[model samples]
Target: MIRSVVFDIGETLTSDTRYWADWARWLAIPTHTMSALVGAVVAQGRDNADAIRLIKPGCDVAAEWHARRTAGQDEYLDETDLYPDVRPALQRLRDAGLWVGVAGNQNHRVGDLLRGMKLPADAIGTSSEWGLAKPDRRFFDRVAEWAPGERHEIVYVGDHPANDITPGRAAGLRTAHLRRGPLGHLWADSPAVAAADWRAISLHDLADQLTSRPGGAVPAPSM
Candidate 1:
């Protein structure tokens, strides 16, 4: 049975479109233009550090954009919204005796976001704090370590296959792909055998999947 359920933040529990768009607009560039710029950076075939170099110049651009969007508004950015079903789903998992946690490629500011959303503080993991990002074995290994008994009775649910599902599977955890968009193909190649939607499957479905098969690593799927 699944003892824990880990969630990815962006594109899973929360939407980041406004934040990014506002950032782009602040740079006096069109939203799509900024996206294309970032895409080009990624296409350069560089490591994360190199990619950061290409994008870091835009940090000031992002901050200025956000400043304009939030000027005289509120202390916290209101651009982020929790997915409609997210709070309920997390409650369902917690009520069903599962430890609900968050794992995401976020920085320390994730704590502020969680607090703003009234989410539990203890159930979060950010790359900034952990010094690791998703798809890295160390990220999953840390989650495994934090769980009771260092066992793999866990299920990680997220929208991104490359960032969330792949690493969860690699670390020997069951995975659930939240097919929120067109990226379902990404998870199709993961060790996870199931994908679900808010309308089609509940947290109970994930728990059921884990209960049926515990502790054995499934073969990687063809991505």
Candidate 2:
């Protein structure tokens, strides 16, 4: 029985098209160039941020983020950036008597933006706010802390298996591989992703499945 559902931010609840495009603009490169670089890095199992470094070696991506913010072009997300199913999916989960939370590998500013949207969330958290980021055991531990029931009763949903499904399982929570984003689509059929408790094409699919299985302990995907 799933008692809570915690969602990842980028590519899960919202898209990252604007983010990489902004970086391309700031670096004076074509958006397609940056997009290709991001795909290349991900294909090599490297961090997506490596695309930025691939453009300008030894570049401090963090510093660049600060620079963008100082220029009044900081990271942000509004309704337009969110997926069409996000609002209704979250609301559906909440209506099913499950706790719904939003947390991800994002900074506090992004967290603030999510909260400001007044989405149907019980709580919203971010990596910067938690002082931890995903793929780290401690980060999933922090995410698990938001649940109202046992770890197994909490389903951690995200697009990336390494940061989400893998670490989420290690943290003793159920894992849901949300297949939509770059990493999500590219690795959707991988063995790692196949190990998640659930694989969802959309939040609506997830909400329907989980809610229907309440108190029944829907089994995890076969290895």
Candidate 3:
């Protein structure tokens, strides 16, 4: 029986466009150029953090973040940053008595950020707190711990094929590939996503999957 649904935060349940655009502004890179660089980073199997240094060598990201915070310009997510499908999908699952959570590779402040935004997640955490990043089997092991279920009883939804789908599937949880983030859009047609237990254009499709199968039975793997 599927007992829990855990979603990736950036670009899965919420859009990080504004935050990335802010980084672009701070770096003085054209918005479109930043977007392209992000795609390139993903293609190279690196996280977005690499883009900051790649664009400007020796740029201290932590220092820049502190400066932004000091200037009252820290990038923070609000309700508006959430995807349109997030609330309804979460509500639907919760209404059906399923536990929901938001977990991803992010800074330690993510819990506070989600709380301030009032996202309806039963649990939330970031790599800073979890001590592991996605695509790492240990990370999904931790997620399994959080949900307190057999691996098959949990669903992990995220936009990154390599980061979200691959490891989650390997860890024995059902996986859903959501096409939303830059990596998501870039890899939408990739075989990694094609092999996911579910391929969804939005979270609503995930809700449909949950409600379509009752008694914790997972729907058949489908695109």
Indicate which candidate wins on TM-score. Answer: 2
For model 2, residues 1-223, the per-residue Cα lDDT tens digits are: 7788999999999999989998999999999999999999998999989999999999998998889889999987888999999999999999889999999999889999999999999999999999999889998888777678898888999999888988899889888888887899998888878888888888888887788886544454332
Question: How many backbone overlaps does candidate 1 show?
Answer: 1
In candidate 3, position 156 carries an lDDT of 92
Q: Which residue pairs in model 1 clash with each other? A: 26-65
RMSD of each: 5.9, 2.0, 2.3
Q: Which of the predicted structures, 1 or 3, would earn the higher lDDT when compared with the native? A: 3
lDDT for 80 (candidate 3)? 82
Candidate models: Cα lDDT each: 0.58, 0.88, 0.82
TM-score, candidate number 2: 0.95
Cα RMSD, model 1: 5.9
Pairs with steric clashes in candidate 3: none
For residue 115, what is the lDDT in candidate 3?
Answer: 68
Shift of residue 215 alpha carbon in model 1, Å: 10
TM-score, cand. 3 vs. native: 0.89
TM-score of each: 0.67, 0.95, 0.89
Kindly give the stretch of ten consecutive residues in candidate 3 with the minimal lDDT sum. Answer: 214-223
Better-scoring candidate (TM-score), 1 or 3: 3
